[model samples]
Target: MRTVGVEEELLLVDAESGRPLSVAARTLQYAAEAAEPAEDAGDASIAASGEFAPDEVPGGSIEHELQQQQIETDTVPHTDMAALGEGVRAWRDQAITAARRAGARVIASGTSPLPVEAAIVGKPRYLQMVEHFGLTTTEQLTGACHVHVSVESDDEGVGVIDRIRGWLPVLLALSANSPFWQGEDTKYASFRSQAIMRWPTAGPTERFDTAESYHSLVSAMIASGVIFDKGMIYFDARLSHHYPTVEIRVADVCADAADTVLIAALCRGLVDTAAAEWRAGEEPLALSVAMLRVMSWQAGRFGIEGNLIDPQTLAARPAREIVADLVDHIRPALRENGDEELVERQIAQILERGNGAMRQRTMLEKTGQLSDVVADLATATAGLEG
Candidate 1:
């Protein structure tokens, strides 16, 4: 309940070709105006030693993610939704213009529909990753918008993650953007989710009851050398030891920055409300990991069209109704955050026709080519245009 912020992993793509652009160098060069040595010291990035993500953009510029293809943009902390939107919009618009000047475009989808050739800009860290994780990892170059909400305590972070797991599917369904893969429709809402899961440390996490337990597991995993660093524990939800927030990593990057803000608001609101309920002596409702996995699979495979089992009532509900129910549940948080209208609009858009997957499919059906998918992606990225 303290405040909320977001880290968006954006794909740098060729403006005319829609292919992934290896412009982290050029993009970082553009950010040189703001990148001081002290400001660039982000929690050790997987991208490169020089790669700057959350910190380089003080005034607003694209930062780096773990991969060379990624530009991690961040926001100023805000307790209310309006301030969150303003910060996020300003940052995204700056990134888009900077990317445009470098012959690139910014798209925030969870995965690129077409396979962006593994033409990494060739950094040592990227090379290290390739040697460690291999070609499949490079081939699955995807992006997601990570939302972090500050908590009053470590216990609150754990509890927030516990209750928030049930809603991960709903959030993913609402933000699913990777419909096509390797120039063909993968017939799923978020091929990005699956693609990202290819990594050994990626995807949904096992339930944990305490911060001690979570920290112990991560420490053991990192020590075992399976995960290179703490940040590599890419779970649906994790307590960011780096920050005091329960970070929701389930959502794909929305094509639009507005969509990104909505996702962040909804996520922050849910955590705040759930924490409040927990404080009031309400038991944290949790479903089996099996149930959560299946629901997440349904969301990834069929999106809002698929049926999902409700975690609270144990009854199957249409994904749409469930999403509406979630929006309603988070209304107080959204209203408090000054994003009531956007939260409603984003939910309506998800339930109305479908997510990015549906729109990408329609575009492909109309033109019968990956080129059309790129066009649709461009349309989806419109919110970030300067």
Candidate 2:
């Protein structure tokens, strides 16, 4: 089985007011301190107060993000779905604890519900981004859930990316979490997707026939000076620069750990299915980039509430039907990995209870307040509510 990992970016907000807070630096400091050895009495006391011990959680990490209003957590790669789920929850707890110590609360929201003037983290690369991109950098405070699945080689990774392009929009629709942005309802299931698409190189890419072609395209893009580096090659799915894996960057940061795990499981299933197809000498779907972009837009607009473009027919269909097809398409892979039952249950739950976007909208409709939406999201993020 291919090992899978997840990286979730969470929004930090004022606990009482439910407004975005710029305390990521302080929260990271607290996390670093908690990870230190408890050599002194005071340190032991702090440890007793529920701060996470570094050794207790292996291969997971909490880190700062480009924006100061959010933090990102990376789960250790795992072949077992249960272990991957536990890693996600543990990291979320670590982030929540650190945010509390910093006088903030962490919520798994793709965009802030309240109005916010995002502060860019004062890193050299980030500073350069702001200088070059101006408003695109200044206004980009969105969060996403990036999943990495291990691949045998770069050729296999590129093959997976190519074969999985059409199905990527379905994942986006399933994990759409951003409904409101800057205190007003954006009326889109995932406004974060819209926000992210503002970047020149931040959407779906054309299929590369081989790994060399993929690398050559990336190198040419970098040499053109349009982007800063290979890191900016923000395709919906691509080969990871540092890892022997394919990174899928389509989904929003889901508020529930179960939802994140489901996405990761489905991603791994897609990679497995794609690799098998490649091995069997199957041809990838020759969808054009323009069509793929339209599919993505539809997913980001309606989520699971309305319709999505069917990758097979290129026709709009009910979201539930499309999602069902996705499950069927990847059923063999899921079953082989011992995740079929869990994925089916989670998909049913998401469809019935609603995804993060629907839940956010439902809260606002029930409470008539966006603050309540944020509060609900915070509770969901902390795993304190069902």
Candidate 3:
């Protein structure tokens, strides 16, 4: 089975006021101290003793984002959803604990509930981004969930990406977790999607039938001075430059671990199904980028509450029906991976209880307080406290 990995960005917020805090540097420092090696051994003694090496936390797995208000955690690639869930939960809990020690709380929110004076981290690359993009880069306080599924080759990966582009909006709708932004309900399910769209290279990409074409387009974008680098190729789904995988960058940062697992499972399934089709020499869908953008917007606007543009017909259909179609589309892959039953149950539960956006709205309606919303979100981020 192709392994899947997840990267989630979480906001560090004030425990009492629900305001985002720029304490990621402090929290990471605390984590490092907890994992660092004891200072006692000489270089020769350390070389002699293999066990005395620095017990430091893996720097690459958990790190700061563009802003100090947000931290990102990535899981090891796993073939099983349960293992992925455990990894995600463990990392999240660790982040929360680290933030608490730093006098803040980590909330798995897509956007901050309170207004924030965004503080950019003092990193050279991020500083360049801020200088180039200006306000667009500085205003980024959004968090998102990205799932990476291994692909055998770039050819196969681009093939899978081409076929799977239409189905991404459903994933967006299912993971819609950002309803409130800057203390006001944006009235859109995943307002973070809108916020991130300020990037010139963000959102869906035109079909690149081959790996060569994908590389060509990326090169052209950089050469044209439209983007800083290949990393700015922020398509909804793209061939990962750093990994042998296709990374889907649509969903909001889920408030619950289970939802994150479900998204990962479904994404892996979609990639598998698309690869199978590629093996059978099936032609990829030729959906227009303009239409794909519209569909994406519809999903972010209504989530599962209204209609979504159906992947098959590109016609507006009830969100439930669209979600059902997605399930059927990837059914074979799920069963093959022994995830059919698990994904079905998760999908039913999500449909019944609602996505994070609906739950947040419902909580605010009952409590009539934004702080209550943040409190409930923090509880949910811990587990199933909601």
> Model-by-model lDDT, in order?
0.72, 0.89, 0.85
Q: Report the number of the highest-TM-score candidate.
A: 2
Residue 170 displacement in candidate 1 (angstroms) = 0.4
RMSD per prediction, one decimal?
4.1, 4.2, 5.0
What lDDT tens digits, residue by residue, belong to model 3 across residues 302-331? Answer: 999999998778789999999999989999
lDDT of 2: 0.89
**Candidates sorted on lDDT, descending:** 2, 3, 1
List of clashing residue pairs for candidate 3: none
If scored against the real structure, what TM-score would every candidate get?
A: 0.87, 0.94, 0.93
Enumerate clash totals for all models, in the order shown.
Answer: 1, 0, 0
Q: Report the alpha-carbon TM-score of model 2 versus the true structure.
A: 0.94
Task: Summarize candidate 2's per-residue lDDT along 1-386 as a digit string, tens digits.
Answer: 89988889999999999998999989888887776454532211223222345345323667778899988888767899898888788778878888999999999988998899969999999999999999999999998999999999999999999999999999999999999988889989999999999898888988897999999999999998989898898889989887788999999999999999999999999999999999898999989999999999999999999999999899999999999999999999999999999999999999999999999999999999888999999999889973
Instruction: Decide which is better by TM-score, 1 or 2.
Output: 2
Worst 10 residues of 1 by lDDT: 41-50
Candidate 1 positional error at 271, Å:
0.6
Error of 1 at 169 (Å): 0.7
